[model samples]
Target: MPFSVYALGLAVFAQGTSEFMLSGLLSGIAADLHVSVPAAALLTSAFAVGMVIGAPLMALLGRNWPRRRALLFFLCVFAAVHVVGALTSSYGVLLVTRVVGALANAGFWAVALVTAVALAGPEARARATSVVVGGVTVACVAGVPAGAWLGGQWGWRAAFWAVALVSLPAIAVIAATIPAGRSGAALPSARAELRTLAGPRLLLTLLTSALVQGATFCAFSYFEPIARHITGLGSAWVPALLALFGTGSFIGVTVCGRIIDRRPVAVTAAGLVALTAGWVLFASAAGSAVAVVALVLVQGMLAFGTGTALISHVFRLADGAPTLAGSFATAAFNVGGALGPWLGGLAIGAGSGFRSPLWVSAALMVVALGTAGAAWTRRSAPALRSDVHAYEQGSSDG
Candidate 1:
């Protein structure tokens, strides 16, 4: 809850904008670069790929570096790339910038998550994570839209310039706030951290993280079409709906932070189930304006709330591998982010209607929920049996 922790959120906000802002500029970028729209869209994919690969790699590579130094390093790298991207006329150069920017962003999150926990303490890890994730939701609500508007007004390159400019202040804030120590969280050796990957508990937690994000993006990716086809909303309403979803998500992340550490499994499982039901309701109540609006808001809340909880679970589950934890969690998310939209695209392309992605989202959430439930049951079973045996023995004596 320190001001410094919030400063870390500022860093995340800057990097996150770079990740989500491209969608609004894709067409303009395609036209500017004389590439197909589909080709232009590959920049997004390139960013994701960098994020996935960069998280663990950068985290490990900088495992020994000072936390403050590591954070600033990533931020500076991210900002520099955006500047390069903004100046580059060649599509190929811009493509490389996206990957480099994402790599830097991933490193920042890996270090930031650990730093947030160190700054806030382990007891408030979830709360610290909420602060971190709250940045992304704010990016969704504000950054993406602003980037789109900027792109429309000036050009796609201007959005890139804006991102680079926005990131500069984050560098100053993060450097001023974060500890100068060589690393806040002391990491185990690389061998031991890698061994942690073999743990079932961590693997399950990672899976939950992926599914949570996958489910979220699956439905979110097609929100524009869903609004148009299902609720028959005009183009004007789409941004409002997305913003509403972001607002709900911001609220949910805050709420989840308060209780996730206390009731991680119960809250996450319940949330995923609720999200699944919300998707079903969305699919079924397509014609109802109120239902569509309500479901979108609630779905956003459940998705982000559960996501924060799951990542918190990952940090806990991978506690022994502190150096690797955040990176793995980050990787799980990018993996999910990439997969979800692909699935949604497939669903829509197959002519299953706009709601097909809703079903896909529901199914993925159900799986995530089931994974958490089953793991809890499995862990609880032995304790339950031991209690029963003791109770039966006492009864016989009585």
Candidate 2:
């Protein structure tokens, strides 16, 4: 992989830390802002809402600009918003900042994924994506835990400030390494991009992405509560468990990247199945501390490992519009992000234990598994194979 790919990962790490860090900080935030824990948890949903809106809007806004420039601009905005979030004591202002920060974060992801694949070319597309998305896994391992620890000691505001500070070096690295005008394709007209994105295959793939992500977040968004109430772990142990989950994710993504190009459908289906099993196991064994930890690790691996194949599958189905396809994928993921947490909150409020979300997650993954199985059956069609071949050829030629 190119050094620039790692630079993109660094940017992702900074943004992802901000994104996932909230899961651990929800209690502190609720108390500090004079809100209920579930209400404070809405901040996660608010960020996802911003991502769902921002992906296309930011793509359109930056359509004419170089990918590098757009990335830099977005990262700066992301950092600034984190600073705003850190300084604000008002809950309303903090909520607004999460949305704005997520807008910036969404733009960065859209551009970063496209740029990573472009740099690596067709042959290494999945690996390139894994390398970039690895930043998020690393954040789960290191950054999120650090933020949680910081919040535990200083306050949730300190966590936001830490993210803001982290973004500076990421910005500097991206500026110094990523070359201008060297990544991404020429911007197509809005009409053309929309038409490409509207294809049935791409749409189905996007739906699969949404379902899979929703399943993961349904349980994951409330992991802290699950740890406390279900596993009987203290607050200090939550970050370490999260790190174990992240480690599993790191391993999953790495393995998926190596084989996804050869067996995209099979790999995705297997991941979904594993994810379903993980959730089922977690739900069944919620009372056992060891079982809960093991199941979380398994869930994290399957959930995140499937992401590379899903995105790569979308890129293949996209025909000629990878950037827009990427934006749509990002939007779909966030749509899941927003819905999962909201639904989980409802379940919890309705007196469903924290384990309820795991069952819910398992059910959602079953749906995603069906979606993946359907796509697999279509994979052998002559027309689809031809299109895939053409896409591969075009990518290589470019």
Candidate 3:
């Protein structure tokens, strides 16, 4: 892979850390901001809402700009927002910052994925994506835990400052490395992009992405509370547990990358099954520290492993409009991101307790499984084949 690919991954690491750091910071933010934990958790949902709108909208806005320029613009916005977030004392201001930061984050993700796959070419698309998405897993492993620790040691504001500082270097690296050119074929017209997005196969695949993310975040949005209240862990152990989850995600994405292109369906289905099983085990083992830790690792692996395949599948389906397709996939994941935490919050508010989210997560996975199964059955239908055929022809001509 090109160095630019790794640069993009670094950029993703910076953005993803900011996006997920809120999970670990929820407790601290709630305490400092004088709000309930569930209320603080709404920050995650707000970020997701920004992402769900930002990706596709940014894709359209940057449709004609050089990918490098677009990326730089987004990163600048991301870094600026984090600085603002760090200085904000009011909960309302912090919430607004989260949404604004996420808009920049979503734009970065949309362009970065397209750039990674373009740099790697057709055959290595999954590997390229893995290299980039690996940043998210790495953030899980290192960045998020570091942020959590920073939050615990200093304040949540300190973590935001750390993220902002880290983002500066990413901005410099991307500007220096990523060439200022269109990464792939000329983008399709807005009408063509919409038509391709409207296809049943693509739409179903996007739904699969959403369902998978929804299931993961349902429990993940409440991970700290689960660790503290249910598993009987102290605040000190939260970052460590988050790191363990990240370790599992890192390993899962690494392994999945190697095989996803060849066994997309099997890998995806197996990951979903493991995810559902993990959720069930987690719920049952909520009180057992060892069991909870083990289930967290398993769940993180299965969750991100499935993500690799789902993203690759979307790329295949959207070969005609790779960047827009990537944007759509990002939107779908955030839609789930927004819905998962919101629903989990409602359950908690209803007196269901922290463990309630795990049950909700399992149910969402079941829906994802059914959606995947339905899509798999129709993978061979003529309409799908024709789409693939047209994509192949376009690639050859380009």
Candidate 4:
């Protein structure tokens, strides 16, 4: 709620922009570097893999530092990597830059998130966290499209340069606004929280989260190529399409926020089923530009809707440990982020064509749907039965 909280969100915006901007730039980067599109796509995976590995590791390594200091440190490193990435001609060096940038972004996220919550105080934790998350959504809606457009005009390296430029201002904001102190309250050590993840219900929640992300990104990571090769769109349309996808995501999260708490399991199940259906239809429809365009919005909506509900469920399951919840959610989603692009890349590399990624997306959703069903039958059935029994007894007394 405070200016400091918003400043933290600004930092998050810079990191998220870099995280997602690569999808739009993949084609250009590939052609320029003389690599296949699939190979270039691995940059997304590289960044995600780094995030998966970096969040907790960076958090631990900087556990003693002031939150503001850590935030500046990470942002500076993030900016530096982008500069290196932009300057490099070699695909391999660029790939390494993506990984390094992600590590820095992951560390900044780990530190900044708790700092925002700490700044907002205990009762407003979720709201504060949402401010940070809202930054990512805005990055999707605004930053990604702008990055794509910039990449289209000046070159892909321009997008990387743009991220570095934005991060500098963000760094300044964080330095000016965030209070210098211990990043967050000392709570249960991450070691103690490991036991919480062992629970079947929590694992199912995380699995659903991972699968849904993987499914969406399988197609999404290649949206540019899909537009170019499959839909027959020019480079100009790619940025607009990416914008539409991002708009759908913003709307999906907003829609889910209204209803997830009341029917979390049901919403997740329905979203997974719809997303699966959407992907299958998309595979069949890829030749039709109109169909492909329309389905992008539908697919985006369903994917984020399911994903939003799953994250809420994750927090609910890990309520007692904020640090654990944050790190676990980051790791789970990025696992999907990393895996989705890599798997999709493999499909493309195998000469499966662009449609293959759509099939891959659908397959992942099928697995997610199964996981949702297992959670419902295995975890919710007992609770449902008890509620039914109480209702029956009350009726009999009446």
Superposition-based RMSD of candidate 3 using all C-alpha atoms, in angstroms? 5.6
Q: Sort by TM-score, best first: what order?
A: 1, 2, 3, 4
Per-residue CA lDDT of model 2 for 1-398, tens digit only, reads: 88888888888888889988898799999998899998898898788788999998887788677878999999999999999988888999999999999899988888888888888888888888888778989998999989988999999999999998888887887888778774444667878988998876677788888888898888877888899988899988776777888998888888888989888767887787778888888888988998988887887888888977888888778757756777887898888877787778788889988878888888888888777766666665777789899999999999
For candidate 1, the per-residue lDDT at 155 reads 96
| TM-score between candidate 3 and the true structure | 0.87
lDDT of candidate 2? 0.84
Q: Pick the candidate with the highest lDDT.
A: 1
Model 4 poorest 10 in a row by lDDT:
122-131
Candidate 4 lDDT tens digits, 1-398: 68887777777787889988887788899999999999998898788889999987887766667878888898898999999999999999999999888888888777776676667765555456556666776798899878988999999999989888987777787788777776445766666666776678888878988988898778887888888998898988876787788778766766776666666667767787788899999988888889978988877777776776777676767755555565667678788887887799899999999778888988988898888778767687788999999999999999
Q: Write the per-residue lDDT of candidate 1 for residues 283-320, one digit (tens) a residue.
A: 88877889989888888888889899988888887778
* lDDT values, one for every candidate: 0.87, 0.84, 0.86, 0.80
Winner of 2 and 4 under TM-score: 2
Decoy 1 TM-score against native: 0.95
Tens-place lDDT digits, model 3, residues 314-382: 888887786687788889878887788778888899999999998899888888888888887678677
Q: What is candidate 2's CA lDDT for residue 298?
A: 82
Clashing pairs in 2: none
Colliding residue pairs in candidate 3? none
